[model samples]
Target: MAMNGETKTKAKSNLSKRGSKALTPFSPYIDAVNQAKSCQWSPSNEEGFFLMATAESVLSFDLVHEKIRTCREVPATVGLYGNFRGGDRLRSAIAKMMERTFMGVEVNSAHICISSGVTAVLDLFFFATCDPGDGCLIPAPYFPAFDNDMSIRNEVQPIPVQPADTHTYIPTAEEMEKAVVEAAKRGVKPRVLLITNPGNPLGTLYPEATLKELLLWAVNRGLHVLSDEIYANSKFGSSPDEFISMEKVAQNAVLENLLSAELVAEFVHTAYGMSKDFGMNGFRVGSLHTRSKDLLNFWQNMGMFAAVSNDTQHALAVMLEDENFVDSYVSENKRRLKKSYELLTTNFKTANLHFMSACAAMFCWLDLRSVLAESTFKAESELWKEILEECHIVLTPGEACHYGEPGFFRVCYASMPPNQLQVACDRLTAFIEKKRRKRKAANIS
Candidate 1:
């Protein structure tokens, strides 16, 4: 076959280091979907619910229409090139919302910088703060996309910090120190400690004490704390404890003299977005919140690289400004999330399956260790294949997230409706029972 012009150009081209970064287009779920595209058990790619899609959580379709209805209310001003720190009004709206969540923590619109997505924000943040070959400390079994966004092009390695208790996966200061030491031994300099508050996949929130401990460790080691609170508004457990913002932690640390106000201001940064909280993935609107003038100005100067459209910024800002609609949406979203969590957990109990107790984010860390035929990543891969190919459902196996160990998977529950959850549960239960029956028959044979 004759190579096309574009293909020929690629074959002879020499690119810059950043441009020459290997394209990692591999996604197991995408591969599986493509393989079954012609004849699928679940026709829509939406059934791949492990993707943390929360479309059903809020009434965005109607809300968007409402935004259009009030379109005339916005002033007739040109927004051809949006403000670098996002629209002035949008930044103010975001700051107000955050202040509500992290009360008494000073946050101003001027200190906030907007980007197209949290991923873009992270890419810029890492590029600004870390040189090539530097590393960031991340807890194990994290959101895997960070590897592609943080490292592939930017060369900022994410060194996984294993929990002191492997079984529980609870992060600690000791684990952070050990991870830092381990990275140093490998000749990688650990520069940032990134915490996914109301963590992804794990769906758990860090305790105030644990946050303080980690913050102190970061401050002492001179590591920047990148608090990823993308799911800050989505926390929905009935427990007495609630999702605590690291902003609050920073303020408390300053008050307690654990760190000076200047250090706390300089050391802490946050990434927030509408994707998780409002189920607005298509909006491409996310912001970086920090008091560091240097970083803020750096992002502001380069903000146009991934500037969100002025139209979208205005629409979302209007939606956010409506306190009544906002309250209703939050309450309804929490109700749906809690219902889904309970529904999934109750089924887990019925099946005698185990999972980590969680209160936030869109998924749960399911323990499928007992079902594995062997304790290996290979076993995990086989089990995952069987589940996806046969059951027409999706759950992210731990190995995909670069987890140290295997036999765990993340099932995103908030994406689908109760009926869909029922079907997935039925399929999962049947699969487990079939495995059990095979074990019994083999023993008898």
Candidate 2:
């Protein structure tokens, strides 16, 4: 096929920005290793010194027993290498579960394409839906990995929607709409809007009404919605009825009254995983749900290039089929999360620090302006570095999450044990006090 003169000109313009330079490869594992080396080690040489980003829950005897039983029950045929690409039976089972529990009204076995994990699903979705240099809209204070994955690895341009407030980490729908329009005007029109529901760092769960509005807006703009609902079941202080899936919202007449089914169908892609909800990070199982036949066909073609491991798919299928197990697991985790949030909130309140509202998820977004105001550290990243150096405490700086302000940090409540959480709170309070005293002494001098 011959390219038109206009198309050739646009290609040349894009190529000019590249300047014939090769892209740099990103290795997160290498980064993690270097970070670990820079940090102090305890005299005891204990592993507890470094807190993990997301740690799996300690499995109870019952859960362990169930897993053992499931392993035994898994057939020899299921273990065969041919089943390594995921079997139809396992896919069908997962699809059925999605249809029944997830409000996936029209899902079938064929609609399901198993992936190694949420990251794999995202990579596949990007491969299927976007070309290199295509635009993807990601809200600020996002999962940092996504920026690395989409922008760095996939060669996609990430148009950031900055958070309204550094503390809140909530980007308003209006702001998002404006960003999309602006991106389109810049000739980098977004093909996908990535939303991390029960948001990362901020931990705010979007109300059904808010999600509906966003969906409608995306449909109007001809943008695809990639809903990252991995934290869907981690909601604190919310009932199951309060949680709304994109599929459910799209199907609701009163909720999506303005948008027709055809419009709604085009805009939605849901990504859910067992890692966040079940605390099974090692499982690496996740699903991508979409109603668009065209999108599904594209994904199917992409799957031909790469597929998920069959063993993991079978494990996920078994887990999904056992609703009772998932319910019990979610219930216990929710209780733990609620309690952790309460403890953290109490500590922050005692220190005269405030956190933005966090209804669900593992993190609490904190405003560090009061602490920053009295410190020599001019930026949040510097403050974070100082904290690590002086207090030996580690928290994600908001700047790293794409919030430009130098007055916010994210504390992960889920990864810390109860005692560790208490110690962390004490260290934070002490750090604030120490900084205050230094400022006061300097003022006196």
Candidate 3:
């Protein structure tokens, strides 16, 4: 092993100045994603099943071919870097979809910017609005992926707007302002307020009144408002307080002069994506809309870092332009999700696992407090570990979603087939029974 006279080894080199930030370890969300990938289903791994850990739309569709119907002129896009503010045709279609299908008002295509995904758009959006060390006010029971997306590279932190109580984890407008003030006290400048309409972990829709109140709270503080409307067309609920579009609300405020046009232009920005709504996760296309001209021009110049691939743009352009086809596809997707949700809820109820019935997205935010060994997050982690190890199924721990409570988990109802979802429910019920039996044994002793 001596290298004195035989061979000399080269010395190690130093990493760059930003290496600490760049080469830093992956966040917990990345850990979950990796675990899901490793335990994903295949013939060999079929005995060990994958319960949904990540939120994705159901894949039992026969209409994927409908998305990319043509290659006649798609190759023409491959040679160029394309527009930084996104291509006109695709932007126009997105605008139209918002106007006709989801939002009530027409969107200006010039204000839309297309990127590889919502995370990329958020990165650019935050960079445009926030400085290093600044934060965005995010309500708890929020999406976990946002923790790193906000700051992992940009140094912008996600300041959680925690609820007063754990059971009903809804933050009021006052809570939003209080969170901003709290962040300011801690020297973290709150630059924006981010809300997931048809919320990710909660799976509930925000009412218009609640939306307006939060808008006033942010406007009073002069903070930008980022409404993630990625689940716009996923609504299948019968409730009167259904999905409400932020852009539509903004447009109305402008028309009625309740809020000044200048303020609307300066403060409001909306994000939407294809991955969830259209079930085109692989396409990696997302859109952001704003009324600010300065921000639009800034993206036009520098957005090449994560611009959508031209072929994807072309393929989506064709699909989104077909109003009738888009309408039918959206309707069918909702119908299927509603059916799956019903089955999941039925099983959960039969097992006495109380869960919040949702209006949108693929998850059921489960309340597992009754079965917890102790009313603490540590005990919740132990329960989750047991299920993941013994049941051979993955479930998202509420702690990962920044939940204020200790005993909650998000179980996706749309990621797998209906029959498989039934199996997942059976396995969960068995876990609950096992825990109950253990508790009874301890009591007897």
Candidate 4:
């Protein structure tokens, strides 16, 4: 389906200037993703593609679906126009769930705004807080789609703060400072610092001490802090008390006089959703919890475009209101996550592949440096292609995640059954062994 020269010219002319720059007509990563979708691995399909690239957990989806099914029927008002900021029933349920589950403090429903998804929540957040060309400082080895989330419409620039040691993933205070200076040089004003708790792809949770320090640092620099806690309830392989919400950290910081209450109210915000924690990505439900009256005012004027459907809101509200079901569901979800993570890591160890041990998110940062032909990003891209095209296993390349180095990839284990995971491991290990043998023969020659 190659386009002729004239056809290509016609297609290019059809697109708007901004649309042409933002859209991709051809991408190897996207091609692999489409292939994975068409041949997804299942029990009957032994030759199917292994989709380990996306951050989706199908482990406890049955529980979530059942809860949604049994929840109260959608209201008649759903047929009519609903509140732009979200219904009181759903927002109140979310506020209470925050207290009962993770936040450890009461949240005011009035301060919460419901949106179609976290993607939209962040889009509106940036629109309200920053002007065009303003930058948000995000750490390297972070979520790749954030480029789309921050930029596609809002025109907010993402300035990556890379760590001194690429393996650490988290950038140091000095590194962040340097990023701000560099952003200024590029004429991008640094307006926000985004922290992904239970780090995406890395799956490492920030310690309470480190969280406090980062919050204080942001406040001192007059940067708004947006903590995306979408995976808050997904922390496994640890005590429940080990997982702390950003709101709790902000409150404690204020109590300790490290941050002013006014500053914390205006600057600190949280984004949460049903996608990761509840295995309800299809629900398309996300919320923004902020104490800023300015943000709420902005939403009042422009929130209708991103509001969640009334029926979907009601169903999720009922699900959250059932405290017993919510409690048991969370416990079982974590157990399944822990089991899947252990299985994946055991296979990695058996294959002599190095990985950073993860406790929260569904992904593991896998190192394939030993199998690379050279220490370059180009080599990394080639390895990714080989694994996908030859081994039939789809993994996200480190380059896509903006990681500072090569030979690393994100492996999502919770997206498949254990049996399929074992098959994937066998294929991957076999590929690695063949590469090693060829390297040995080449060295001897």
Best by TM-score: 4
TM-score of each: 0.90, 0.82, 0.92, 0.95
Cα error of candidate 4 at position 304, Å: 1.1
Worst 10 residues of 3 by lDDT: 1-10
Runs with alpha carbons beyond 4 Å of true place in candidate 3? 1-18, 21-29, 42-44, 69-77, 165-168
Candidate 3 lDDT by residue in tens digits, 229-303: 898888887855868888777767778877888998889989999988788777788889898888898888768
TM-score, structure 3 vs. true: 0.92
Candidate number of the best lDDT = 4
**Residues 1-445 of candidate 4: C-alpha lDDT, one tens digit per residue:** 1111011223455677767756652234756676577877777986678888888889999898887898859779878877788889999999888778888877999988999889899999989888989999998788878877888778899887777875555566777888989889999998999999888988888878767877888878999999998988888886323778888999998899888889999999999888998988888999989999999888877889898889999999999999999899999999999998998899889878899878998999999998888999999988987887788888889888888789999999998877778888888888988998999999999
Model 2 regions lying over 4 Å from their true place: 1-48, 52-69, 79-86, 96-109, 165-170, 238-241, 253-257, 304-306, 373-378
Q: What digit string (tens of lDDT, one per residue) describes model 1 on residues 33-89? A: 334333323436544423222222432334545654675355555357768778899
> Candidate 2 at 70: error in angstroms?
3.5
Model 2 over residues 81-113: C-alpha lDDT tens digits?
A: 543224676677667765665444667666566
CA-lDDT, candidates in order: 0.77, 0.67, 0.79, 0.85
User: Model 1: runs farther than 4 Å from truth?
Assistant: 1-22, 33-78, 102-104
Candidate 4 regions exceeding 4 Å error are 1-11, 25-28, 239-241
Ranked by TM-score, the better of candidates 2 and 4 is 4
Query: Which window of ten consecutive residues has the lowest lDDT sum in model 1?
Result: 1-10
Where's the lowest-lDDT run of ten residues in candidate 2? 1-10
